[model samples]
Target chain A: MTRHRAAATLMPLMSLALAGLLVVAVLDLPPQSGLAEPVAGAMDRAGVDHPVTAVLLNFRAYDTFLELAVLLLAVLAVWSLGRRDPIPARPVQGPVLHGTLRHLIPVAVVTGGYLVWVGSSDSGGAFQGGAVLGAAGVMLMLSRPRELPMLPAPLQRLGLALGVCVFLAVGTAGLLAGHGFMGYPPDWAYPLILGIELVAALSIALTLVLLFLGGRHGH
Target chain B: MATDPVNLQIYLACGALLFVMGVHALVVRRHLLLKILAINIMGSGIFMVLLGVAAGGEGGVDPVPHALVITGIVVALSATAVALVLMLRVKAATGLARLPRSGPED
Candidate 1:
């Protein structure tokens, strides 16, 4: 009881001290009006075209490609590292939670698909959707831990390669048409952007799910 | 209210807070999963900071930062997967969820 009291007393004091620091930090900020003009000028130079798509495919296509490569490497690392390890048999935890997740998994999967589909125009996208799908896999694992399927090595490799493959294909096609890498012909911009984003979202989602599943050899 | 640079400042501050918290988590937590969460939080902070920096003018938020953030988000998840896999392997080997401690040698 004494220990509980001591912790309770200390928590509030710590919180109050933190709150005071936050207030001071906020108060010290410079006034807002002085920063407007320079920022606006920078924005003007950036060109107000389809900024999001342009940023992804043109301005920083190199970064996007590398990012895809990183996911591929991660999948490979996990696969190689886990190859020699013995697989632990997962024990069944509870029936109630398992039953609940059985229904929840499909819902999560459908919602994730919807998010990826609508990502181009809406607040959600492939990343969010993929995370949701990964979470559903997590839920399934937690409930029916032993039932999770092992991912085949070839399929896992394919999943990791998918993102990079799509990216390079589009980029090379663009180059063949007399544009630089990833520089789509003006008429083909929207279609190509949608295609790339869709593939990226799916590949990324699967890679993440595989990662969460601990790169096991089955599922 | 009309667009203001102050909003950008607020976003920057939020990002800073997220980063500091992530650093603190990295220092204090031994659990690998929690560490992954901390890393994600830090990535989120970076994204927020970039977006805030780009939101300079009256026009819509800069697409460059948005694109960068999206890429960052993907990379973060990729890193998270690799980390999680490592953690799982460690768990399988040691039967513990926490990272191995460095011994006092030197």
Candidate 2:
């Protein structure tokens, strides 16, 4: 693609002006010092000590659920486009890649699990865990580097739907119980969130890996 | 919003800088991949602005914005992945890496 010389020259100038305006706008902001009492209470009610996790899975679970849906939909759109050329265009066996993946995969899985576990109480969460797992999948793909489906069709489909379905089901169950959508019973909040995170992590991990793989492999 | 207004200003400025750079890239770059990268940069900038603004609110670093940023990162990646796939498809079907300046409005 030939570069557009005029646009290229103008861009930096325009960007600088925009940056200046943003800097000016930011300078007017006021600082906050402490957590408000009501917010602190909401954190407590979230069943998770970490305020961020509380917000993600409790106060605004709908957002997280929708995020998962978006991920799944992205993969579906890719699949709908039809098959991808086998990765590498040329198949070459790499003993080096195998050696690295052989060790790296276990670490990825363990770290992913650890992140998911710690998310409720600390900085880690489903997205981070899913990323680690997805990274492992990419490592696997590098070693295998095939156009063929590494996973069975049914499993791929299942993974794609798993997170969203679990989320929706729980939300619906809450509604049935008259607790409002995605509102867990107070007594069950902790376990419910933990379980949902685990399942959502699995779905996210698989969906991401599939999307990266590009096109439908698992017929 | 930020707990410290100084940090808030710094972060929002950073975000703004990134967004401007991304917009520049999107306009100036001819490659599809570069455009996608530019979009991701813009997304990150927006996320930074979001967190920066929330951190400066009446209450300290609010959970809501933090969660939203986290969600945004994941969503951004999903969108980038899809965009990359689309780019690849376009390339495969046509020999060009990007649409011609005046293609049929893809």
Give the Cα lDDT of each candidate. Answer: 0.67, 0.80
Docking quality (DockQ) of candidate 2: 0.51
Separately for all candidates shown, the number of backbone clashes (residues 3 or more apart, or on different chains) is 5, 8
Model 2 / residue A107 / CA error / Å: 1.1
- Over A74-126, each residue of candidate 2 has an lDDT whose tens digit, in order, gives 88887887655765443366876667767888999999999999998999998
| DockQ values of all predictions | 0.28, 0.51
**Model 1 docking category:** acceptable
Task: Write the residue-wise lDDT of candidate 1 on B30-99 in tens digits.
Answer: 7888888988887887787677655753545655667778877777776776777777777878998787
| Candidate 2 global TM-score | 0.89
Report the CAPRI category for model 2: medium
What TM-score, computed on C-alpha atoms, does each candidate reach? Answer: 0.69, 0.89
lDDT tens digits, residues A115-164, model 1? 76665555665567767877886666545546645566677677668778
